[model samples]
Target: MKRRTFRAEVAHVNRPLGEALAAELGVPLEEAARLVDVGAVYVAGRRSRDARTRLSAGQVVTVVLEEGGQSPLAAAPGPAPTLRILHEDEDVIAVDKPAGMTAQPTEGRVGDSLADRVGEHLKRTAGLVHRLDRETSGVTVFGKTPEATTALAEEFREGRARKRYLAAVGPVALPPQGTIDLPLSKDPSRPGRWRATRAANGIPAFTEYRVLHAGKDFCLVELLPQTGRTHQLRAHLTALGAPILGDKRYAGAAQAGGIPAPRCLLHAQALELGHPRTGAPVRFEAPVPEDLARFFAAAGIQAPSGPIRPLEPPA
Candidate 1:
């Protein structure tokens, strides 16, 4: 189904969010509230399910509408897709998350998220250790027991886990290897978006990249994020002037290296962390998806074979 998105900046304050959306979109207040009820509304780059939320001047609001003025998020529910299990043990369960599936359920949305699917598969509770963007596919782990969950969560909170991602971006003019150290925060002027900020109040984010292949119009690179922040890789790549292919939110090209790309070309290729139960180092790798493999072949670059080596210490 075709969908259209509308964004508006509030000029007046102290009004119900639904009322502001109705004025901006020329829809009834009830329709605007229904949009929020279905998770179709976003404020300041985050989804807001509360129609009664108070709006402030200069705040941005965004809504997605399907053809014929229906909320795109109000579609009929479907059965959860089977998961691709990478590894499972008494304490932890690792799965290869597919693109287009959210890591967790969103408020006011009716569908099974990755977490729901995992819990259903195991017939018990599963605690997510970390999260990935809905469009990013890769290895993600969950803890089965409370002890395991706390231990694993602590590892990530303490910055002891290592992550590596593969991405294809528009041709980069920078060096083959470099680092992006930028501060990021919500874009006050644009709803549902983040931007780099030079102000001290912005959150610090750091990402290191190494070019693996450079075509005439695109480049394949490996990304290592030292600090985990929302959309860190996507924002950092955009800051470097080489946004990932098909990343419409970041001004990426629809086609890269003479190939069509329908979604952001980014993959969480591998993850390494100490086991919560045994305290032993363990690594999980996800095979490159077919879409990425096709990109690699079109670019005349061979995909990495065998286990991916650990990322070198940042210079």
Candidate 2:
């Protein structure tokens, strides 16, 4: 990663740190403010807070942006026919993602990704319109061109796109289901991690869960989130006292006698949106992955029924 730093003075005693930094760096205030926003700025060798805080003269501030580039794994050729195409067209394509494959490449995770495999299969570069968790596998859609990518992104930005997930939670007793309304925010102590809290400072998020079947130690669930945020579903389920099995990072450890989960028991069951070019509604679905299916079978849980429910906005 590339790193850059700018040194600036605190001209006035009451000037906000971000405003002063932006003025000194000759960049937009918002762009300069992101240093503090992402916790990258330090004043006098200590972490600075609140872009609006007053500043003192001669106070040195450091702004840094770690360089980001394609992961090395992205360079390795994808395994032949690794991607399973579920739906394809001139403008858009959807694939059934396998567990452990990232939707896109990240630092140190280059070779094994949906983009690499999909690009190899279609003989065209695939652009990710959105993302799914690395451990949560299932259907993911992509745009074949820059224009298509932009249109698909706009659909998600305008809240016209819908996504649903399927998960297995151990010892299911959650009300055949109910909505989990919680606000989530990044954990202050851990970067790139999120937590659910009743605190009002976080973004609004909601997930509706319905129990499909209950077994002796596990339950199949259909999950619908009204808004997407980092780790919203996992955190919400954890808060509900029925965290998805095999979710070690969030749920601690896999329970004994519970279907032995190897990954987070979450899948992108379906996606519904409009064609970027044609403006026609489109929907895609992916079946439960073998891991989850095998877990259910071993636990003696019945097959989950019903296509995922689509929640409509209040009329």
Candidate 3:
């Protein structure tokens, strides 16, 4: 496909790249943001993927578009999705985020994120404290106010909040319960992917796993991540020879226990943290969605009845 490129100079200071591109291209903000996300936006001759990148005055910006294709400006928006509210208050809100939904806006897509749905439901902007992978379904939280956003964000950054994930994986050879302390780094050869590495410069990643149920060909494991690194759990599990089922990026099996995998068999089952406004402990849980529940039933493995406790001391 032939590509078209547009270039312009930034005339204002501290302007977002998307806004600048929108004005230059005479397109909507979301369309411009999509261009930036797909690596079609450049600042000072350097490719920038973040739409929110702030530009200084006099800096040059460029945008490239494919010729003879559906222009981003002309793309139709999808219907707004709904979120299952698990908990809500003046300061915070928690919801059951379904699979196939991103926590926030992503490349080549606009709206339809958990954050966007939460904002629509609340009729105001909701601040996402953390995010889940697009295919992982379960409990997710958002801050309703700036103060709560800061406090909750601090809790996650400091590893004060507890996160629990339930995943179905192929047969495992490791111990029933243990910690994976492998460090992680971006896989340079594979753009937008991560891998477990032993290099000295690798960022530390840790996860504790306990086998909740072991079937003939599959095992249900509960994962507690001690650190919040991108793709940490998926990478660590793949390194341990038991990648999450249906996680094609991590070399997980396509089927488990004769059941064809639909999507990554991972779920953010629960989350616990102190109330941002009151310091009182608060917890949220999301019930297992239909796909996962069907997998468990067909595999003859019983899901955990309650929140699985950590095998080691909390971080």
lDDT of 1 by residue, 1-315 (tens): 233344444454778888888887788888888878766676765677799998776766666666234446457345556799999999999999988878986532333578878988889879998999878888899999999999999988998888889988888777777778899998777776778757647899988888888877788988878888998999888878888888888888998766887778788988888999889988888888877777788877775544545446667
Q: Candidate 2: minimum summed lDDT over ten consecutive residues — where?
A: 67-76
> Could you give candidate 3's per-residue lDDT for residues 1-315 as a string of tens digits?
233344444464687888877877788998888877655556776667788888876776655565237653344345555669999999999999988878885433422578767987989989998999988999899999999999999999988899888888888776778889999988988777788879646899999988777777888888999999999988998888889999988888988777777889899988889899999988888988887787678767766645447696544
Q: In model 1, what lDDT does residue 304 have?
A: 58
Best by TM-score: 3
lDDT of 2: 0.73
Error of 3 at 152 (Å): 0.8
List candidate 1 stretches off by more than 4 Å.
Answer: 1-79, 305-315
**Model 2, span 1-315: residue lDDT tens:** 433444444355678888887786687988766656544566765555468867776666665544235322223333443567889988888998887777764432323467867877779788788888888988788898899989999988887888778887877467766788889988877666677889748888888877777777677788888787889998888877778888876763475354467888888888888899999888888878887787657756654434456544435
Task: Give the better candidate number (1 or 2) by lDDT.
Answer: 1
Candidate 3 global lDDT: 0.79
Ranking by lDDT: 3, 1, 2
Question: lDDT for every model?
Answer: 0.79, 0.73, 0.79
TM-score of each: 0.75, 0.69, 0.76
Model 3 misplaced stretches (Cα beyond 4 Å)? 1-78, 305-308, 312-315
Alpha carbon deviation, residue 306, candidate 2 (Å): 6.8
